[model samples]
Target: MNRALFQKIIFAWFEKHGRVLPWRVKNHEDAQRMSGVRETLATYFTKAWRRDPYRVIVSELMLQQTQVDRVLPKFEHFIKRWPTVLDLSRAKLSEVMIEWQGLGYNRRARFLHEMAKRVVEKYNGVFPQTETELRTLPGIGEYTARAVLAFAYGQDIGVIDTNIKRIFARVELGVEANAIPISPKEFQSFIDFSVPKHHGDPWNQALMDFGALVCTAKSPKCDHCPAKTLCIAQRIAEEYRVKTYAEFLKTPHRNQQKKQSIPFEQTNRYFRGRIVDKLRESPIHMEELRMHMETNHGLSSRKKFGEIIESLVLDKLIYIRGSRASLD
Candidate 1:
């Protein structure tokens, strides 16, 4: 496939259909007036945009394994309260946890708190420019570090998230998401090769939107997909014992049932979250806390109950005295 042509197709679609997420505040409405050119992400956004690296990190941390709809209100309220790394650094862990009620992955909240503190204390509230330095912060991983670089700093790096992975597996590798042939390291390298210079921000964002809207997990809109012409999966349909797109979609990912999501209400995760949530109100007697978990949440084993409390203590989300447990 021609790299230049691939980029042209992807970008043309994005000029028409890219999302205006809260995290990426580029002026989509201004594209047409400006001859359909998307704005590049700078060190800080335009004054009208108000997107600093601080907003980028906060939104990124909150968005880990969490959806946009859930994170939007929380993200807004969060930055509104603590608009800068300096402000977040001063907040108590308990206060941050309280503000992080609805988002289930509680450790991410703690990590965000620690990350803010580190940024303020070590770097004087300035985000590091390099990926090596950024990864030193708590909870900032491979994908996140590059995301900050591309979306916030406009660096030319690939972010191989699940959406991008799915797109690549289909369009590049002619495989389904569940059956990629290479290891993560190799797949990342393949993704790295796809990023175009000077426009990696829009390019990566375009792939993400294309995957989410067109090249989706189960029901990809192959007929309407702009890259359907170049999608290796479609081009090689006959090789998979299929000749039509409809049959090709069924043949490749036939067993690709979405993993059944366990209800958050029925796990230790639920109790762990509830323990923090209950503690946010006030301290409670140890016995009363046990009773609440067992009675309300159907906690069966006393040993499991003790483990939950002990784990929360280990995680420093709570502290226990003689007969009471409270938020740390």
Candidate 2:
């Protein structure tokens, strides 16, 4: 593959069509024009916008397994509420959980709170710059660590999230569906090779935008894709004019197969959310909580409900005082 040509095409497309996100910093001319402030792009960009590690960390954590549209308002609200690591570290975890109501995976909010506390106490409230230091924080993994380094610090490191991985699998490896797993080592090498040396941040962000908008997993816009000519999977799909790689690969029988039934209310996640939601309002006695769940949500087993409460207490998500339960 001609790497230079590939980079040129992708970057050109991104310049014209990249999404105008709130977290993204505006160009120098635009920033100055809007704010009536005479500052260099680098100064405004680093000190005021995208280079703020706290904003990047909050945005990244909220975005895990969540969509961009859903994250935008929440991210703005969160940052407005806690503008710095020191502010977040000083806030109560229960208040944090209350703010994190709509965004599920409540555990993430707890981890984020813990991460803030640690950063304040251990690192003097400044977010870490290196991948190793970042990974030491709560709930940060390999992908998230690299993302922080690249996006916030402008490090020339590769970031391969699910979307980028899918793009590489289809465009480079000729894989039809992103569901087909690629070796981690192979994927890392592709990211390393594809990421440009100088424009590492924009390069990674462009690939991410391209994957989300054009090269989506369910229904790819193959005809409109910039890399369609060079994409092996797209070339193969053209024979059938396939819109979705998964649909193209599905057998008729499998397509018609019935999905298994799982009751939402009965699941642990649902009950846990309910418990948190109720506690968000006010503290309730243990017996009163069980009765409310049984009456409203058809929760029949007291033993099962007790187990769930115990788990929540163990997770430090809630506290039990005498006979009452409330968010910690």
Best by TM-score: 1
Model 1 stretches astray by more than 4 angstroms: 26-51, 238-247, 252-328
* C-alpha lDDT of all candidate models, in order: 0.76, 0.74
- Over 1-328, each residue of candidate 1 has an lDDT whose tens digit, in order, gives 5678889998888767777665665322332233344444332123343236677787888887788899998986886688678889999999999999998899999999999999999999889989899999998997888888887777777888788999888887676777765556546656776889766677788898888888887778887877877878787665555554446667533333223223557555677788788889999998888888888878767887886686567556799988999986
lDDT of 1 at 3: 71
Per-residue lDDT of 96 in model 1: 97
User: Could you tell me which 10 consecutive residues in candidate 1 have the lowest summed lDDT?
Assistant: 42-51
lDDT of 1: 0.76
How close is every model to the real structure, measured as TM-score? Answer: 0.67, 0.66
**Residue-level lDDT for 289 in candidate 2:** 91
Output the lDDT of residue 243, model 2.
55
TM accuracy, model 2: 0.66
